[model samples]
Target: MKTKICGLKSLREIEIVNKYTPDYVGFVFAGEKRKIDEEVAQTLRRELSRDIKAVGVFVNEPLERIAKMCEKNIIQLVQLHGDEDRDYINALQSEVEAPIIKVIRVQSVNQIKEALTLPCDYFLYDTYSQHSYGGEGKRFDEMILTEVYKEDLSQVREGLQKPYFIAGGLTAQSISLLDNRLKPFGVDVSSGVEISGQKDEEKVREFLLAASKVS
Candidate 1:
């Protein structure tokens, strides 16, 4: 599986991912403690090479602002982790040059099926949180994902699997544990790869180190 490290705050963190060369790097654009200002996010995104995809994670953000920021930062992907409608997602795609990633709050297979209709370049299966949307550090039942894999996984693999980035409570051990059964397109880490709720460079390096072996 590929790897993506989220909630990046500094150029140092970005450089870590760039040196390791994870498929994608994510930045949060909403919430109080979690949200990153547009100026800093844009500056940091500028430093990323074009080959490495830069993602902006948004939760209930206005479409107009999202389009503007993505354009300003030259971000390649937008990861939506809120209660956004299909039309809104489609409209956003029409307005921006970059692609979209519609995050599904997977409580059941039916929720996974709902993602099939969304207009997105990628799909991220993250832990559903009542409080936080994307980087809550909580994991959903892997068995739920396993069951989905057993059924229409081939379809997912054939279509969107290449760019699919898995999120929610993933660590080195978890990546190693999951490598055998579910070889995903990519893996995304936020809080699980951190120390004391802040981004840990060693944890990030070690997680990517483990992912390189599995992916």
Candidate 2:
């Protein structure tokens, strides 16, 4: 499975990821704690390895602002982590060419099913939290995946059509617990690889190694 190391902020963090090199690195443009401004994001993106793609995480941000960020090549992918509907996604798509990853705060199988109908390039299934948009480090119920399949195992099943990343409270041990039937396209990590609220190089290295072992 692919690995995405999200919530990167400083130049040192950029250097660490460049060396360890997860498939993708995320810059939080939404939340307060790990949030980075446009200038900082641009600087970090430039220092990032060309092999790794940068993803911008947002929570109900203005369409124009997001489009501008993409236009400047600060982030290759956009991850929506809020109450953005199909109309907002459609409008955003019309403005930028960057691929969008709509985050489905998985409260139920129905939410995942509904999100599949949206016109985005990818899906990121994260644990739902009323207090925060994401980076909560809490996993959602894995049983929901089984429920989705039981509900509709059809060829036209929209949920299975698109690729998705799984996030929230993920670690090397927790990743091993993932059901084989619910094969995610990739895995996203934030606090799991952190130490004292900062990205730990060893933890990032260990997580990446673990992810590599996953089929």
Candidate 3:
């Protein structure tokens, strides 16, 4: 399984990720906390390792703005975390070639089923919250996964055709707790690897090590 360390800011954090690179690192372009401006993102992107991909997290951001970021090669992937519909995605696709990751705040199995129909390259399943778009560090009910796949924790199923990443309340131990049968394409972590609102190097390393053991 792949590992994505999200909500990374500052050159110090970038240095940490460079040393122990995750498959992907995220820069928050939306929200108040953890959000970075275009200039700052560009600077950090320049320092980031080429081996690791950078993801730009946004919530209902302007298409031109996101497209521009991709055009500038500041972020390798776009993660939509708001109420953006197909038209918005279709329009954005016309402007940029970067792959889009639609985040589905899982509330019910039906919601996941519906999201599968969207025309995005990947999906990220995060816990639903009333107050925030993401980075809440709360795990959704795993029973939902069992219902969607309709299989035992040790059996694989082809129900979800698209590759996806799981987010929310994920830590090193929590990742180990994931049903080996229900493997996500990747695992996304933010607050889970943080210490007092900052990225912790030891925590990030531990999280990556745990993910490496999966699959």
Candidate 4:
């Protein structure tokens, strides 16, 4: 199973990622406590190991700006955690070479159903948040996935272009809680891996180790 560590802001966090070496690391361009500008993203990108892919988090950002970052190799993947629709995704796909991972904020099963149809490289299922797009460290009822799987397991597995990641308040224990039969493509953690409002080395390592077992 792939593992993604999102909302990274500091060089220290980048260094921690380097040590743990998750499949994906995120740079939030979207507004939040963890948001970073393009310059900082570039520096972090440079600091990141070649093996770890950089994912740029955006919310309703201009297509050109995102495309420019992709073209310049500042980010290898684009994670859209906004109100971006199919039209927006279509426009972005035409302009950039980087793969897109659309975020589906889940408050209900209907939202998951809706997200299944979006044209993107991958889908990230996260908890619904009124005040934030994601990275709020709040988890939704993971049983929603069980409901989806029960409804029509084969269809969701086959129809989805790629394996999707589960995000929002994920911890080592939470990762262990996932049903073995319904494993996600990956698991994303941000605040769960943080200690005292910052990414902690031990927590990062622990999270990665736990995720690896399931992956």
Error of 4 at 24 (Å): 0.5
Whole-model alpha-carbon lDDT for candidate 1: 0.76
How would the candidate models be sorted by TM-score, starting from the highest?
2, 3, 4, 1
lDDT (tens digit, per residue) of candidate 1 on 14-124? 777777677788888877655688888887788876767888889878888888877676467888888887888878878887878878877887677557567678778
**lDDT (0 to 1) per candidate:** 0.76, 0.89, 0.88, 0.87
lDDT of 4 by residue, 36-154 (tens): 99999999999999999999999999999999899889999999999999899999999998989999888777667777777899888888888877748888887877677566645
Error of 4 at 85 (Å): 0.4
Q: Report the number of clashing residue pairs per model.
A: 1, 1, 0, 1
lDDT of 4: 0.87
Model 3: lowest-lDDT 10 consecutive positions? 150-159
Best by TM-score: 2
**lDDT, model 3, position 32:** 79
RMSD after CA superposition, every candidate: 2.6, 1.5, 3.2, 1.8
Q: What residue runs in model 3 are displaced by over 4 Å at the alpha carbon? A: 151-159
